[model samples]
Each structure stands twice: as structure tokens, then as C-alpha cells.
Target: MTFTLATWNINSVRLREELVCKLMTEEAPDVICLQECKSPVEKIPVERFQALGYTHMVARGQKGYNGVAILSRLPITDAGGRDFVQMGHARHVAARLDNGVTIHNFYIPAGGDEPDREVNEKFGQKLDFLTEMRDLFHADKPQRSILVGDLNIAPREDDVWDHKKLLKVVSHTPIEVEHLVETQGAGGWVDVTRADIPDGRLYSWWSYRAKEWDEADKGRRLDHIWATSDIASAGHGSRVLRAARGWTQPSDHAPVFATFDL
Candidate 1:
């Protein structure tokens, strides 16, 4: 059977529930991992999504801050949320599907604009978060696992619009990239997107600060889908729904998807 999984940072669930439903009906991913939900679990508008045929959900959310959720049509078990140093934010949520595949959704810190750890505390926290993640996952090294969400780091030069110009930028900086690489190496996680578009300018996120983000085309591939090496071979087609970024009242990021022939 072929299963499709998607990752998207909706920014806020209550505000974009309609758009989420629209995407669900249009794309029909078997599982959708979301980040930055910005709403409590009860306020996530679950009924609307359930009405659309998604009956299973595992989410960790705050009032209006960092949050992550997994919405699946298939049954999900072992639902758990990571505290990550008691940070008091809903940043990580994971579940195991009946197919025996585990899914982890994360919303790593944005690391602020400063890019300097001393100046920006968020940057320091972001690096520490990556370190913690590396340590946690490397211990077990899951085989039938998939990780997805807005990781907030662009690992390759081509993953950004202009790598040279954005070298100083937080998302594309050397330090951030190194941290992400370390995490990937620790977990032996193969980037599903890279399995297809090996070399090219691929981006999943655009800053809302732009007057015309599409015209500017200044974007960063902050979102990602990763699979354990054991099941990485199952990864086939991967795509980014770039046009969705232009939808009315759209979020700054678009949906990234990958299909696995399990």
C-alpha cells in the first residue's frame, strides 16, 4: 500500500481551519503533521476535521504559541508529547500508526533574526533543542519512523533562494545548518524531499513581510519530511504545494508532502 504524509505550518488552526479542510479534500494525504497550531487542544476545531473524514488526532498545543499536531485517517497509538526541558510550550508531538510506522512532528525555535547566540536567547535555545533531539532519537534509532514539520532550518544551499546572500540569516546560517546536520546524522534520517529533487532551489516557506513573496521568490525550505534509513527506500515521490502559499489569507509556509510505498 502507498501512504502519503504531509507537513504544514498552518500558523493558527482556528483561523485557518477552512483552509486545512480545503487542503485535506484536495490533496488527501493519509497523515498530516502540522506545526504552530496556536490553539489549545479543545480549540483545534476537531469536529470540523472529523466531519471531513479525519478521525484520529494527536496534538500538543498552547494558547497562542508554539504547537504541533498529527491528524491521521488511520488509527494512531502511543501518542505522546515531548516536554523538551519543561519549556512550557507544545513543540513536539508523536504517535504510532496502526501500520507500525511512527511519526514525529516538531516546530523548532525560529532562532530570531539576530543569529547570534549571545544576542538572541532563542538562537541558543534552538541549538540546545537540536542537541536534545539528536541525543533523544539517536539512543533508539527508530527503523520504521518518519519525522515531519517546520524544522526552521534549511540544510542545503539550494534549499534557500539565495544561500550566499542569506548566509548570515538565522535559518540558513552555518551554525543552524550544522546543528540540523548533526541531528540528521545522529538519527540517520534521510531527507525525503532530497530523495527526489536532489539539486535545485526548493523552498517551502516565505516571509510575510514581502509585498509579493511569489514575485520576490525569496524563500527558505524550513519544512521537511524525514524517514529512517531502513524505510527511506520506500520514499518515492515528494512535492511542495507552492501555489497554496498564494491562497487568500494564507499562512507564510506551504505544505510539503512525500509518498511512501510501504
Candidate 2:
């Protein structure tokens, strides 16, 4: 089976339902994993998506905060989720496709402005969340699985517009990078996007703070897609839909895509 998958942080699905439908109409990926849905599962407005042919969905949501959902045209069964760091946030969900591929959609906690855990509790939570992820993946030893979402960390120097300037920043701090590396190692996961586009200043998220985001071009590769090593080679056609950021009332994030032949 071959499928195209996309991961995006829609910010708020209800507010951006039109954008979601537009992507479904335009890009038509076989499956899309969404983060930061910001609505209860019951209030997700599934009918709108179902009308667009994405009838299958597995979602974990909250009232006005973090949420994650997987919408698929292809059949999938709920594979469950986790409450990492015991934060009790709707930050993760998983589903298994008919072909036995398990997809995990995540919305990792964004460590606050300060990098020091002593000064910032959110930073501590973020580190703890990554630790839980590393522990879980190491214990379970995932295979034929893909993990996608706004991981909230940019591990590579090139993943940031100005690496030196961002080194002290929350997303690109050395500690966060180390945690992410350990998590990837624990899962034995391969970064599908980097594998496909090995050399470049790639980014999937541009801050809305920029007055002219496109012209300023300050961005970070906080979103990611990863596959277990066994099937990593089958992944290709990786891309970030940057133009979507310019859409009407767009989210700061742009969808990241990867196609797989399994």
C-alpha cells in the first residue's frame, strides 16, 4: 500500500475548518494528522470533514487548549494514546491503518520562554514529556510505525533561520536538542523529511510575530515526521506546504508531507 500523509498544527480546527477542507480538496493526502485542535472531541465538527470524505477519525481533545486528531480516508482503528509527564493534556493520539501501520500524532508541550527548568515549570514539563517519550519508545520498541506532529524542538542547527541566535531560544536550546535526540534514538526512528531533503535550511513553522513572515523568513523546523528504521527507506516525497501559511487567517504552521510505499 502507498499513502501520502501530512501533519499540521491547525491552531484551532473549528476556526480553520475551511483551511482543513481546502487542504483536503487541494492536496488530498490519504491521511492527515492534526495537532492543537483546541476543541472538545464532540465539538470538532466532524460532519464538515466527513462531508469532505475524511470519515475516519481518532481524536483526543480538550476545551480550549491542546488536542490531537487523525483523519483518514483510509480505514483505521483507534490505537490509543498517552498522557506524558502526567500533564493530563490532549497532546497525543494514535491509530492503526488497515495495512498495519500505526501512526502517532503528537502536540508536544512548548517549553515556555525561559530555558531554565528552575525558573520555568513549562520547561520542566517539556523535558519530562520528552523523557517519557524516550522511555516509552525504548520499552515498546516500535516497528512499522510513524510519528508525526509539532514536536516543539528544532534539533538541527540548520533547522533554525539563525542557529547562533536561536541557540539560547526555547526551541533550539541545547538541552531540548539533546532530549529530542535521545527520544529518536530510543525509538530507533528515522527522520523522513531530513532523509528526503538532506541539505537545506528547511522550516515548517514561521512565527505569526513576524510583520511580513515571508519577507523576514524567520522560521523553525519544529514539526516533524519519523518512521521506524525498518520502513524508513520506503518514505519519500517529503515537503513542507509553506504557501499554506499565507492562506486567509492561516495558522503559524504549514503542513508537512511524506509519501510512503509499503
Candidate 3:
């Protein structure tokens, strides 16, 4: 079976429901994993999505905060788990499709302004979250799994428009890069998006802070799609929908896509 999956940080789903509907009509991915939904499960406007043929969904949500949701046209079972390392937030959810593919959706903490854990408690929590995920992946070793989300880090120098300038920035800080590498390595996951766009710079997020974000084009690879090596070859057609950033009332981030021939 071949299916396409997309991951996006919608910022606030309520504010972008029209964009979501547009994506459904245009891209028509089999499964759509979203982060930062910023709404409770009951208030997610599921009927709007349901009308678009994504009749199934599994979401972990809180009022006006971090939320993760998965909507699929295919049959899916909520594969819930204790986000033990990063509990107390609506930041993770998983679903198993009838095709035997497990999709892990996440919205990892956006470790506050200061990168120093000593100064910022959120920074400490972010590090702890990464550490916990690393330990869990090593212990259980997720198989036949595809993980996707707004990871909030740009690990590679090429991923940013101004890599040299962003060295001290939170997302590109050396410590955060090291942790991201360590965690994903422990999971034995393949960077599906990078595998497809190997040479040129690719990014899924541009700051809304920029005076001319598109003109200046200072962006980060905050979002990602990864797969276990077992079916790595099946992942292709990877793309970062950058044009969406130009849309009226757009999210600071764009969606990333990948297709799997499983």
C-alpha cells in the first residue's frame, strides 16, 4: 500500500481551518499529523474536517495550548502511550492504521527564549524531554514507525538561511543540535525529508518576526519527518510547502510531506 502523510504546525487550528480545508482539497494526503492545534479536543471543529472526508481522528489537546492531532481517511486506532519523559502537556499522540503503519505525532517543547536551562525552566524541560525520548527509543526501538512534528530545531547549517548568524540562537544552539542527533540516532530513524532534498537548503519554518521574511528568507528546519530504516526506501516525494507561508493569514510554519510505499 502506498500512502502520503503530511505534518504541519498550524499555530492555531481554529484560525486556520480554512487553510486546512484547502490542503485537504489540494494535497489530499492519506494522513495529516498536526501540532500546536491550540484547542481542546471537543472544540477542534472535527466536523469541518469530517466533511472533507477525514472522518477519523485522535488528538491530545488542552485549552489554548500545545496540542497534537492526527486525521486520516483510513481506519486508525489511537495508540496512546505515557509521554513519561515529557508528561503534563498535550504534546503527543500516536495512531496505528489498518495498513500496519504507526504514526507518532508530536509538538516538542519550544524551549523558551534563553537557551540556558539554569535561567529558563522551559529550557530544562525541553532537554529533559529530549533525554526521555532518547531513552525510550533505545529501550523499545520503535519499528515500522514514522515520526513527524514541529521539532523546533534546525540541526543542519544548511537548514537555516543564515547559518552563521544563527549559531547562538536557541534553535541552532550546539547543545540542542547534539540532543536532537542523539535522540533520533537512538531511535535508528532515517530523515526522510533530508534524504529527498539532500543538497539545497530546505526549511519548514520562517519567523513571523521578520520585516521581510520572504525577502530575507531567514528560516529554520523546525519541522521534520522520520521513518525507521526498515522501510526507509519507501519514503519519497518529500517536500516542504513553502508557498503556504505566503498565504493570507498564514502560519509561520509550512507543512512537510512524504509518501511511503509500504
Clashes of each: 0, 0, 0
True-vs-predicted CA distance for residue 174, candidate 2, Å: 0.4
TM-score of each: 0.98, 0.99, 0.98
Q: Which model is ahead, 2 or 3, in terms of TM-score?
A: 2
lDDT of each: 0.91, 0.96, 0.91
lDDT of residue 7 for candidate 3 = 98
Error of 1 at 137 (Å): 2.2
Which digits, one per residue and each the tens of the lDDT, describe model 2 over residues 112-199? 9999999999999999999999999989999999999999998998999999999999999999999999999999999999999999
Location of the lowest summed lDDT over 10 successive residues in candidate 2: 81-90
Candidate 1 lDDT score relative to the true structure: 0.91
Best-matching candidate per TM-score:
2
Best by lDDT: 2
lDDT of 1 by residue, 132-196 (tens): 99998789677798999999999898998888999998899998899899899989999989997
Write model 3 residue lDDT over 1-262, tens digit each, in one string: 8999999999999999999998999999999999999999999988989999999999998889889999999889999945645457998999998878789998889999999999999888888888888999999998999999999889998998888888888888999999999999999999999999898888899888986888988889999999999878899999989988988899999999999999
lDDT of 1 at 201: 91
Candidate 2 global Cα RMSD: 0.5
